[model samples]
Target: MQLFNSRLLRERMQRFSFPAGGEFKKKINVIAKWQKSLRDSDLSKTKEISIQGLFLSKFFGEVLGYTTQADGKKEWNLTQHPGNDIDARIPDGSLGFYSSDKSATKAVIELKDAMTSLDRRQSARRENFTPIEQSYLYATKYDGCNWIIVSNIREIRLYNKSKTQSYYESFNVLQLEEDEQFKRFYFLMSKDNLLGDGALSPLDELLQTSEAQEKSISGDFYSAYRELRLKLFKHLRENNVGYDSSILLEKAQKLLDRVVFILFCEDKGLLPREILKRAFERGVSSFLDSDQRVWLEMKGLFKAIDRGNDKVSPPINGYDGGLFAYDGLLDSLRIGDAIWKEIVELAGYDFESDLNVNILGHIFEQSISDLEQLRSEFDGLELHTSRANRKKQGIFYTPENITHYIVENTLGRYLEEHPDRLPVIRILDPACGSGAFLNQAHTYLQKAWKSAYEQGEIKSKDARYGTLFDYNPAENDRTILLNNLYGVDLNEESVEITKLSLWLKTARSDEPLENLDRNVRCGDSLVQSREIAGEKAFEYRKEFGKVFEEGGFDIVIGNPPYVRQELLSPELKEYCSLNFETYSGVADLYVYFIEKGLALLREGGYLSFIVSNKFLRANYGKKLTGYIQKNYTLVELMDFGDLQVFEDATTYPCIITIKKTIPEGPMTFKYLRLETLEVADLRAELEEKGYEVTITPDSGGWS
Candidate 1:
């Protein structure tokens, strides 16, 4: 625990030796044979059990020098639960040491075949790339264990338990082919190192070094994003002049979204790395000399991205989701060369890693200095102030924990019940502000579809895109984004961000982005009739006739926006009164969203929304409560009473999940009230609480 250097630890590990070097040498030759066989055979035919025997057991037993027995008694637990008081659930295998003449588990070992990837970004990873988020869960759950060793046969990685995810070390199998790589791998991971010559193991020394480095580093993606945003805002405000406030704001927002996405593409390898950075540097000189536009470098790339392979200097594939579409006003606008220098400098930092899309779409934080200053500078325009715009429009940020909960219970339940429906299932987020719900849903289905593909449950013909023989789960991630995920936002910019977020989430290099404008639309989701809202009217049967004809969506779920009754226009109130019998008078804006969302649900379909808890007790909610009582089957409900779920606002909220089927018996549903605002295994917590509610016509006050 005292001051330790990774260099000194490595030198010590090099001196430590195993007595069974002959066995290790024989295992190395066997590994080469297995590697050749893997290359020769179809990876699809490779069995995980075979991999466990062929690669995993030998490598761990020989190279890493972990023993299976102690005192002639077996000391390794295999193919069963850890058998601990905490987290008794079974994992693939466990690495252990001898203690009390029995195997004492050290780390949960998960072995994967060639099928799944160790890549963190790919959907093919199925969100199982460990030591990131899942490791934290394992750290606490795996009894007193603090480590997990995971491998996909091709590579092996080691992660230590932490309250938060810390970076880990990965030793690829290819490392065994080279002396230096093998030495490094053996030094850190060998059983001799774990049982060090000194008081602490080398891995323990490395952990201390990493933890210190982690503590020294600070600041998050939002801060970095805000800094970059400030620079852009200042440049836009000072330099641009030919347009009105709205146009100017639109140009600024669009340019920022596109640039961030392009930067993301560069990091993802979807576009050539440094395509923008190099071009920006090259264009600085060309800008003052050229007779064409001022920022010609980006314009050319934008055009090439829009037109597919038609134009290619920096070599970009088409990404036409309205993000790269010709924005004449935005493209033509020129900024001082100095701004581009700052942009090129900041572009070196990875935005995709830093800027998460969950809170990225529109600037929602009212406390941000840039937004507060922009509000003052814009005077009364309300251009850059998205919080005001969002409040007025009745949209808010939905947390991923919330989204994951709702999506799992709703879409997750549906998928579990009908696994065959993966190819044809439909999900929608009517008020998908920045595509949080849609993104969650996309990820959920991506994992399901990928698992099904790996298990041979999904046939070649079931592929969403490409030929039968060429069915790829990676490409299907895009097809699923295009086909399965659907959303509607009143804000045009929000709709664009939704599309951009989805594109960024699943975009493949040089692959055409399926135009998603038709899928995720921009309109007032509550307004249906033309006479009521005219151009903004989003009639379900008319605008989404295909969805209607297909018996509406299979699941409709999201965090419907929070807007008070007073914000409703008289016309909107009247329209609501005439159209919906759910909530009488000018109810909270979320009430109308509920009625519309449930109405759009296919029979036996599910609809869930986390909205104001006031509807359960307030006099205004009588109509809605009665309507749902008589018309739908309540599945589950959670009163997040007094528990502050949203960071931006203090509101009493409840999550309600409904099945679009009229009740056949007394109103009974699983329900609970959270005492604390912590994100954990919600389903397990609900079951552990063991609470339910029943209501009848003669029911009295329950609280």
Candidate 2:
């Protein structure tokens, strides 16, 4: 079980480099000139300003070829310390950049020092898309190229308005005299070519003697194999190396062969022919010759065959078409249309919209009981705890009432309008702990589809069952899951829980559950900031092929994570800054998801989500609002009104629904201002008001 040691591998990678000598100095001079202009102006360093003038000057200089004037002085004049004691001032010497070209200037950049790293700046950078946002203003006022660069000395990155691309370009300086190790880091930062070609890379570092690799491989073969696979994938990605599909498949075959050869040789002593024949009956026959078979069989003579019916064998059964071999594999794979159908059914919203209030409302109440039991079960589990208190410390389930409201209010109107059509929806819950949203969504679709099927308005089909639950048992099931939903999160455990919830919702109670690996995946959605790479969640988009070749989703919906500013990882934050091109500042991970959801949708598609009420009025939310106002028709907005939707929530929550393409507005959506909601009335209330609702917080006004 060989695995690449990332720390050591990174050290190895840093040994290679290409220098940036005089070219680096010229860039620095441009920074100096910009800095001079800022120093000559009225703006000075305060603990209160939110803009970093000197860094902005330098960044703008580089982005626009040293062309921006210090016209931002007036905007910079008003300065007050953040009352919350958060770092509010646009500090002196902060680095920033902007593009003025219409296509490129649509993007924005902000730099920060101290509390502001490339990561922190990115949050603010990802959400702001205003015509005169600090980043946009800088770009517009500076009037230059269509990209912006913002950085502190340790890291530098860019924002491209033209392509809506943002990403960190360099981790460290690219000086000629920098240490060799540092140069390797520079190479990684400066050139995407330093990484591999294509997207897939194979694992081959299994023989490394390093401690990390050894630590990862010291477990059982299966455990070691899994770890090694992850390492292999990570190594290729970190180095930016890519390989072809044929290469990846070939590598997989070779690795499996090596495993079989080693296991057989050790088990049979000398690889005896008779033993090989038995093993071959299970599929090993396809890979070995007579000599290898004989060798493998000979080893079996010395091997201990300790027997219990439950003791797993290398190949549990011979290839019998009547039994659990191929069928099991197919079942596990859940390949193609079979899998797709399941997902679409699970994600069905059309029925939910058409259902009368009494029936759907009753179903939601029953779900709440199930959720409470789930919460109790998880609360008893032993796991790492991040926050204090017992109830809030474990896997959080969305209150059933809230889930019902989210589904109906956010999606009901659109679904009602197109009852004849199954709206192809794409939704993601960035921190989908226990998969409350996906589960609720699955139920929403299932109930709707079932009703239609019962009424004979739609014909539904049954799924085929397989005898064996083997390697590909989930293959067909996977396809079913893919059709309905897609999600990404950094929490592996949460992903697992999400899959289980989705499976439970889709499976028939009387039949043995289909052994399906779900469409839900584990990843940092913001990490891919620029390119999605080989992650399965992203793969779904490519696998479908239609969206990439034709267009994107018809609808995007979900509840994104609510990670506080201080809790985020630096790498994740940096990646967000470099990749997410919309707004920046206390970015709220949910904000990026909204931006991504919007991007993944087709022009006329709808976008919906429930987020912090703060964003509705926060300065950070302004650019996002502006972008939505300019590009989308605000179909509806619902303020749940000071309701503690989360058991642990300290802030008010708001739900917003909009369509991607707005046709010449002065559009007035329905508006609802409610004091509080009973768990039972959520669906009815939202439905009665219809799609044209505007709900405003007590403190903020809405037009």
Give the TM-score of each candidate: 0.75, 0.41
Which candidate should be chosen as best, given TM-score against the real structure?
1
Query: Residue pairs in steric clash, candidate 1?
Result: none
In order, the Cα lDDT scores of the candidates are: 0.65, 0.41
- Candidate 2 structure quality by residue, lDDT tens digits, 262-305: 23333323222233334334333435543234224322321322
RMSD of each: 7.0, 25.8
The CA-based lDDT of model 2 is what? 0.41
Model 1: per-residue lDDT, tens digit, 1-703?
Answer: 1122344455565676633477656756766665666567664357555556545456766556665643254454332333332233344566555544655555666655666543222222222222133333443444545566667777677766531121356676755756666666776667765544444566666667644643332134445555666667667766776556555656666776777787878876788787778777677657366533236776877777776764455567887767788877776676666666666665765544333343343332221224434445564433353455446545556655577678877876676565656666779988776777887787777656655654556565644434342247677776677567789877666677777778777777767676887789888898877787778788767877777887989899987778889988888888888888875775798988898898998898899999998888888777777778889988898888978777556668988999999998788888888886653445444554648888775564222
Deviation in Å, model 1, residue 641 alpha carbon:
2.5
Which candidate gets the maximum lDDT versus the true structure? 1
Off by over 4 Å in 1: 1-242, 287-294, 308-314, 332-336, 352-377, 380-395, 460-470, 529-534, 690-703
